[model samples]
Target: MQITASTVSLTVDDVAASQRFFTTHLGYAEQAAAEGFASLARDDVAMDIVLLARGTEVLPADQRDQHACGLILAFTTTGIEHEEKRLRAEGVEITMPLREEPWGERLFQVTDPNGVIVQFVEWATPPAAENA
Candidate 1:
């Protein structure tokens, strides 16, 4: 199969809220928008996102009422610390403080208006092996 692009569609209670969050803070541009839907894209990233309001008829009848939950939308990035600091200066709340793991992963998280967890991560040097 030849896949040309990737997109993630999120069923949110407030499409505008999530739409604003992505465009204002995350550098995504609005590709399209409507009463209860929005299509977003970033020039630097391969992934695009679509936001749909809960109960919108565009969704399957069984899924229309369901809202996005228990999902972490993460981005692997460089200069994570700088990114974190920049976000803090922009008045964005940091839900998870920056921390580095033993296996060399540094990450932090922020919650969007509609409760989507957006996490940023960067890999660092591996932990040294302990002598037996």
Candidate 2:
């Protein structure tokens, strides 16, 4: 099957708060929105996002009461330091400071209003060549 689009639906306690975070900070445009739901998209990214209130009936009966937790929504990006600085200037709290991993992955993380962990990552160096 050919997939045309991708979206991550998050059940949040405050849909408006999540909506504002995505649109204001992350550059996502509001595609659609209702009382307790919002659809957001970014032209540069293929993935879209949908926010639903925790108790919204549009969700499955068993999932309606559940909220998004233990999830880290990450984006691989360039200019991570600049992005981090810009976010800081905008009053966005950095939950994790920028750091580099032994394998050359550089990253930082921020927690959204609803506790969604958003991480930005960049490769510090080219992948090591395999030794035959």
Candidate 3:
């Protein structure tokens, strides 16, 4: 079995604010927007989010929190230092500094306004082979 694509959607108080944050900082393009819903995309990936207006259908935040629903979206880049510097220069908060892990990967993490963590990773390279 195989999965084609994955998407994570969440509720936000302000659609425009969330949309702006994702589009401006994370490079997600605005795909669609309405009074109560909005979508953002990066390349072929997309997320559709909805604003919870007052209604009986709206579940409480605590109930939603009970489920294992938080997600950490990751983006791989060749220029990890450049991306880290760019995000730092723009005043984005870094949850984890760039560091090598025991699992053999260099990575860092940041949390956006909606409490979603975004990870940036740059894999280590193997040494070049010596010509015989």
Candidate 4:
């Protein structure tokens, strides 16, 4: 089998809010939308997003009321600092400040209106792997 794309479905308290946040901040365009659901995609990238209102009937009963807690939607891209600065200039709060890890991963985070943590990461040069 072959996989053509990937999508993250988030159950949020407010579908419209998350829809607006992604479209306005992340350049996602709406592929489809309904009363309590939205499918988003970006032309320049393969990232697809689906936002569902909490308690939406499309979800199974046991999971319908659950929110996207402790889930981080991350993207690995170049120009980490520039993106951070650009987002800041757009008035988007940086929930987690940018920092580089010892292993060469530069990253930062921002939260959506529904509390979904979106992280942007840029990997630096890799050091040699140590022997076991």
Query: Best to worst by TM-score, what's the order?
Result: 2, 4, 1, 3
Quantify all predictions' global Cα lDDT against the true fold.
0.91, 0.91, 0.66, 0.92
Clashes of each: 0, 0, 0, 0
lDDT of 4 by residue, 1-132 (tens): 998898999999999999999999998999999999999999876579999999988999999999999889999888889999999999999999999999778899999999999999987763443332
Lowest summed-lDDT stretch of 10 residues in model 4? 123-132
RMSD of each: 3.5, 2.0, 5.0, 2.8
Better of 3 and 4 by TM-score: 4
Give the alpha carbon lDDT tens digit for every residue of 14-122 in model 3: 5566677778887787767767466676775444334332221345755443321367667766688788888888889788999887755788988766566778987
Which residue ranges in model 4 land beyond 4 Å of their true spot?
126-132
- TM-scores vs. true structure, each candidate: 0.92, 0.93, 0.69, 0.92
Q: Tens digits of per-residue lDDT for model 1 on 38-78? A: 99999886479999999999899999999888898999898
- Ten contiguous residues with the weakest lDDT in model 2: 123-132
Relative to the true structure, candidate 3 reaches a TM of 0.69
lDDT of 3 at 12: 51
Which candidate ranks first by TM-score, i.e. highest?
2
What is the Cα-based lDDT of residue 79 in candidate 3?
80
Off by over 4 Å in 1: 126-132
